[model samples]
Each structure stands twice: as structure tokens, then as C-alpha cells.
Target: MGEVIRVAVVGKGGSGKSTVAGTLSRLVARQGRKTLALDSDPMPGLALSLGLGHITEPMLTAAVEKDLNGRWQLKKGIGGARAVSQFSIEGPDGVRFLQFGKADELGLGTMFASVSGFGQVVHRIAEDGVLSDWSIIGDLSAGTRQTAYDWAPYADTYLVVVEPTWKSVLTGRRIVRLAEQRGAEHIHLIANKIESNGDLDVIEERMDLAARCVISRDPMVTTADAAGVALIDHAPESSAVASIASLAEGLEGD
Candidate 1:
């Protein structure tokens, strides 16, 4: 086995992509696999969903960029090697959380310059012989352009999350095409908020994507979000959590 399996969850906004990504991180970590969930959404939804409210710092990619461009040095003694360690927060389930802070006008130039360096860091993290030996799961923004430009190079598998709606399905197709163009190895689909099995069939037929799993709508998930807790921790027995666990298992198989 390699050091880590890098997975990126991407979909249209409001398609429950971050929820699934957060749940998948917890589920994978619970299986004794060290996991690092990177919130690349820029909106900071994953942190709230994962119950990590105290993480005020930005992710290593953005922070390091800020440092390199002379904006601000986040860590005092940390360099590239200690980059991941500095930004990642230890979760109760042993999953490390890294959230990319919102980009501002001044931060964008530094971010672009830091892209290559960030790629190197991600490669080192994903390659064998690391101490942490954790899988990297990223919750990226909804669009295909951002997924391709910002995340695809680092991800081994791109999990295209979609709902039963027409807009979501179309976005899934666009994501699949963009991921393929970006040289992603495997692209998987996980339909969320499904009301019925027929919806899954329709999505598969319409999008012609391999539906790995379908996560049903759960009121417990809503309640957990309202209460500001991770769905996996708040409602482990919920159908949505179970479905995310199944998705994690499938990714492990791959």
C-alpha cells in the first residue's frame, strides 16, 4: 500500500459535497487509516461541518503562499516540511483537518506563485515513506474550472458528487470531462440527497457516470448542521453517514 490515497470531492454548490467529504474523512479515519481533510472550498463550510471551529488559521497552501509573497508568515519556525503539520488540526477521530482561508485580492498573486510549491508538498505527503502516512481528502469548490485548476494535480481520485436535479447532473458531466482533461486517474460519482433508487438510475442513465453510492436525505444531518457538529460524530447511525462510510470503503478498494 502507498502512503496515502488522495481523494477530491467536487460538485455544484448546495449538492452536499462538503458534508460528504467531511463524513468520508471521519469514516476513513475510524477505520484506522490516518486521514487529512483539506477544505479547499474557500467558503469554509467543511470546518463548520467537521466541528472544527477553533481552526482560525488558513491551510498550508495558502499560508505558505502568503509567506513566500511577503504578505505574512503564519508559522514562526515552520518551513515546507512542517507545512502540513502546522496547518492541520487533530480531530477527535484522529483525522487531521486543514482549511484554506478565503483568498483576498492581495493573496491571489501569491497563491498562483505558490501552486508549484504546494504541488511538491502534496506529492511528498502522498508518496510513501512519510511518518504520518495519511490519506488526503479534499473538499473542493463546486465548479469544474476550480477543481481542474486548483485540485486535480494533487488528487488520485476525483469524487464527483451530484444530486438528482438537472443542474447538478450537468455539473457532474462537466466535472468528469474537466477531470479527464486534467489527467485525473479515476473519477467516481456519489449521488447525494437521493429520494429513491429510481433517481439513481435516472442520474446514471442521464449522466452515464458510474454511481458508486447514493446518500439519502436525512433530517438528522440537518439537525447536526444546525447544532454545529460533524454529521459522522453527531449522527453516526444516520443513513447519510452510513452511505458515506460505504463510499469510503469503495475508495479503499480502488
Candidate 2:
């Protein structure tokens, strides 16, 4: 409703959730909208997929911790204001990026704790209105259990990426239900790694979701991943890129 359109990607593990988030961020940027791709997943894949590399030094991790602990003061316009601005990064595409370093299972009891910190960070970002003029795309972890409770409440739109496989479709359904329970306004499904139009149709039939876009398997995507470059930067003309762009347009329209 405000300036920024917050979006989150959810699905099962290995369902290309990060890939969709990265591509969607680029797509939003290409349309001249300032966008921030928030890597909330502890085992982040967004940075690598977007060719930003592994960023160990997150800008606001400690501040996020303070906020989660309720020790960070939220004065009228001082501490919270400074923290949000200092916590973001500007990527080559002019899109702001942030990551919560990979989760340490042994040290951290559960991924939920890490996500609680992430939720505070996202809340501060949203409340401060620093990214008000931009679109915030959260690359959430696979499965709703790890991130739904913390991140789903912040999303205006939920995009669930799923493959045509039975497991992926079932996962998509579960994520949809989770998002709905979390009060997400708009929920859409994208069928990635699609082999053919028939695959798209099959996904639509199998899952009780609104099919918004379908990206066929692209060899360039694999090559880009191998080279550690963002797919939009490495293969701008790829069919997958075009499909992602169209998906962004559809979101903007909605």
C-alpha cells in the first residue's frame, strides 16, 4: 500500500526459491524500481545466485540481535533510523542487498532463532520506511516451518516457486496454506525448471494455486551458476530471464 512492495519467496528445499528471489529482484530493478533483496535464509543462496558472493559481514547483525532481545531503543527518530540505513548494501545492479549469514546448527539450536533476528531486521526496515521507495524481496528458507512465523507477516505478496515434480507441488501447496495463515494478501505460484508447456499445465492442475509464470529449464542458468554470476547479468536474453521479467510486471499490476 505504501511505496515499497514487499515480496517473499517460499517453497521446499532445492525448489529454486532463491533463484526466483534473485531473478525477481533484478526484474524489479530493470523496471526502474529501487529494490532490496533480503537474504533471510541462514544458508543463503541469494547472494551467490545474484553473483554478490558470500558476504560474511552483514551490516546490522548485532543491531538485529539487540532488537530481537528488545534491548535496542526505538526512539522517535534516532537509533532505529540510523540502524536501518547502516544495515543495507548496494549491489552492482543498484539493488540493495542484505544477508543473515549461514545458520550454524550446532551453535544455534534452531533456524527459528536466526529468523527471529531476521524478522526484527525486516521489521525495522519496513517501519523506518528507508526502503519505502523500493521493493523488498525476501529470499526465505525452504519450507514454511523455518521462516513462516517470522517473515510471512511482512510480505505483501508471496511468490512460491515450485518445479513440476510431485514433491515440489506438494510443497507449494503447503507454503500457500502457510502464507494464507500468515495474512499474506496476494499469493502466486511459479513453475520453474519447466520442460514444456505441458509441464506448466500439469503444475496448474496438480496445485491449487494461481499460476502466474512458468520458466522453462535454461542451460544458461546452469552456466551462470557455475560461473558465479547473476543470471540476468550473465544471460539477459535467456528465456528464463524473460519469464521472470513478465512475472515482475504481473506483480506490479496486481
Candidate 3:
């Protein structure tokens, strides 16, 4: 409703959530909209997927500290979200990339602490309008489990990516419910890997999916992943990239 909007790409593991989030943000940025892309997944890959290579610093370790009680706390109080902009890495197509946290050899405890602490970061930016001046897109962690950490409040709109698989549909359905329960302003389904028109029909039969856009399976995505480049840059003419760009173009002036 303002100059900026927050959109989150969420789904089960291997649903191409990062791909959709990365390319969609790129397109949005190319349309002259200032955009910031945040990777909230513990195992983040949006940087490489977005053609920005890898970001070495994770958001958790970047903004938090351990207290004497051995509890993780925000190092900078409520200003943490605003500070994220100061340190964001430059991403392709004018979109800045930030991270929630990444765990390389870190144990689950540290990862969960990041999860909990990042909930504060998300809530700060989401509701406080810290990032409201720019189009904020988040690549959320796999599964609906993020809802447990109060993460659903971060997005005004939820783009649930569903592959043409039974497990994907079931998981997407759960995500839809969680998004609704958390009071998301809008919920849209984006169907991926649509090899044929029947795939949409099959998905529709299993669930009432009002798909916002159907992205067909394109090998360019695989090629881009293999070569470590953004598909928008590697294969701009690819059907997948073109369709997603069109979708982002429509959002201009909204």
C-alpha cells in the first residue's frame, strides 16, 4: 500500500523457492524499483542462485552476541534491521542481498539461536517499516516450520512454490494455512515444473490452487545452477526467465 512491499518465497525443500525469489527480485529491481533480497534460510543459496556468488557472513553471527548467560541477543537493540541495510552485499540487477544465517559446520544449537534471533530481525523490519522504502523479498527456510518461529509475520504476501508432486502439494497446503493464520495480507500460489498443462490440472484437482503464475521446467535453471550464474543473466531469453520477468514487470507502479 506504500512505496515498498514485503514478499516472501516459501515452500518445502527442493521446491525451487530460492530460484523464484532470486529471479523475481531481480526483475523487480530491473523495473526501477529499489529492492532488497534477504536470505532467511539456515542453508542459504540465494546469493549464488541470484548470480551474486556467495556471501561469507551470515545474518545471525553478524548482528548477535552471546550474553553472560550464554544466550544470544541482538548486539544493537531495535536498530538491528536498519543496520542490515548498511552492510548488505551488492547483488545483481541492483538488488542488495542480506542473510538470516548460514551454518557450515555449526551445530544445530547455534543454528536454532540464529533462527530465534532472526525472528526479531524479521519482525523489526516487517512491522516497523525499516525496509518499507524498498521492495523487500525473502527466501525463507524450507518447510512450514518457520511459522513456529513467528516468521510468517514478515511477509505481506506469501508466494508458495509448489512442484508437481504430492508431497509438494501437501506441504504447500500446510504453508497456505499457516500464512493465513499468521494474517498474511495476500497469498499466491506459484506452480513450478509445469512440464505440461495437465500438471496444473492435476495440482488443481488435489488442491484449490489459484496459481498466480505457472513456471515451466526449463533446463536453463539447471544450467545456471551448474555454472553458478543467475538465470536472468545466463539465459535471459529462457522461457522461465521471461515469464518471471513479465510477472515482475506487472508489479511496477503497484
Per-prediction TM-score to the true structure, in the order listed:
0.82, 0.85, 0.89
In model 1, state the lDDT of residue 32.
Answer: 82
Q: Kindly list the per-residue Cα lDDT of model 3 for residues 1-254, writing each as its tens digit.
A: 22465788898898899988999888878767788887888775788778888665545555667789988777765454555655567777789877755777456776766665676676777567665568888888899988545564657788889989999999999988988888887888888889998998887667697777789999999988888788888898999987777656554433
Model 3, TM vs. native: 0.89
Q: How does each model score on lDDT?
A: 0.73, 0.73, 0.77
Model 1 quality (TM-score): 0.82
* Model 3, position 71: C-alpha lDDT score: 80
Better structure of 1 and 3 per TM-score: 3
The sequence of per-residue lDDT tens digits that candidate 2 reaches over residues 1-254 is 22356888888888888878898887777667877788877675898777687666644544433345555333334343364466667776778787654665324423443444456667766565555576878888888774556564457888889998999988888888877777778888888899888888889998876588888999998888788778888998999889988887778766
Worst lDDT 10-window in candidate 3: 245-254
> What is the alpha-carbon lDDT for the whole of candidate 2?
0.73
In candidate 1, what residue range of length 10 has the lowest lDDT sum? 72-81
Prediction-by-prediction clash tally: 0, 1, 0
Give model 1's clash tally.
0
For candidate 1, give the lDDT of residue 67: 48
Runs of candidate 3 exceeding 4 Å displacement: 1-3, 60-62, 77-81, 105-117, 251-254
